[model samples]
Target: MRLKVFEFDISNSVLINTQTQTQHHLTRTEAQVLEQLANHPNQVMSKGQLSCAGSQQAVMSESAVAKAIFTLRKYFGEPYIDLIETLPKKGYRLNISTPPPEWQQQLAQRKKLIILASCMMLIAAITLITAMHQYIWFKTAESPVRESRVVTLNNHQQIELIWLQSPKKSSQQVSNMEQKIITAFNLCPIVKWRDVYLAFSNDMQVLNISMQGYSSNGELLVRNIKTSDFSLQPNFISPNWLQEVSLCD
Candidate 1:
């Protein structure tokens, strides 16, 4: 039977067969060592050079190279030096035409499939982990509710008010006030508030107030008062009417 060897692309592995079309695959390291042997056919390759070329790191100990050669021999079996002939202290050479047993070819194919499956699973796991991390970051990154308030300057004068709620602290009273203000007026008006003031109470309550001008030349003023403020009203819609009413015109 005519023996043939084929080299694989991008890896140090090879396929060898005798007459039959049956194929076998080898790891890159195994293939590189085999190719070196095929070149000399009957000349031994230096253990040092074989280790360096066959390894991913471009260098390996002599003992490591020898172990790899031994494994290859055990797998391929006779006529193949069994294809490698060891020259003790000298190196190794291929006897060529070394064909593996029919049963072994099937076993090798199964091993390759297992390796491929393992790699695919690892990639999937990494992708899933990354997605989970991003989702958690998005969930914890920002506040869900916005805060706003309105202030009446006089019996005939009233203005719309709005502000961003502080994420640092909160209270049910402040929460109710925020809802009332939002319900009473359109928040985030197109016009800019003229003067802005920020205030805070010992209870961690915060207040933001601003004054804006309406197209009618009328003035619009607003305040965002936290319910936590002790000075807040029972309605809590406007906390400490006087203290929270800083002008923002």
Candidate 2:
């Protein structure tokens, strides 16, 4: 039942910063308001909605919600306080602008990979031009149907999650499989991959999950798992299995 916001633990009426090793116990009202905001990060929420969420009444004064927000921001202190934004006429929005240090490092590594790939592609293009006199035959294979969804993080960054449908499986079967994968991912404590791909076999006997991203050392890494070797629950993928495959550490 715990939810994470970057390094913060937004669960059990407590706010914890894992990086700083600091814990802040929240008031009942504060916890309710913060949970509402965390559950819908980056979206504007009015004070009335927030107050009613905490009080569970038809109407609570906006001032109570405002006070709760002020207290939460005060607890956040300095730079982190900016995570909760207050709009004069609109409402409050939880917009996390800063990403963790490891995330920033990962992004830098990805940029280097892109540059190296571009250089390789340029060299290959030049080589192809020189061999233009030779007939180059290329055979293209048909690709499986894919449905992509962009998962937005608390920090406003996005990662693409793609589901590749097996030709033999019905549309409903593929959609249900994708939902199970998504649920497991959503429950993961830490997600470092830039993209994820889930595919099924033509006979529906094998299921493959691939996570594509660069490791800490700037090396391209693909983590794979298959149902043939792993047992899945009737409803969702196992959280332990996800952490084992999805995380490099």
| lDDT to native, each model | 0.54, 0.70
Considering every candidate listed, which one attains the maximal lDDT?
2
Where does model 2 exceed 4 Å of error? Answer: 1-12, 54-59, 97-119, 127-249
Report the backbone clash tally of model 2.
0
**What TM-score do all the candidates reach, one by one?**
0.31, 0.38
Task: Name the 10 consecutive residues with the lowest summed lDDT in model 2.
Answer: 1-10
Candidate no. 1 TM-score:
0.31
> Residue by residue across 48-110, what tens digits does model 1's lDDT show?
768767445656666767777876776565545355678877888765555689899999999
Best by TM-score: 2
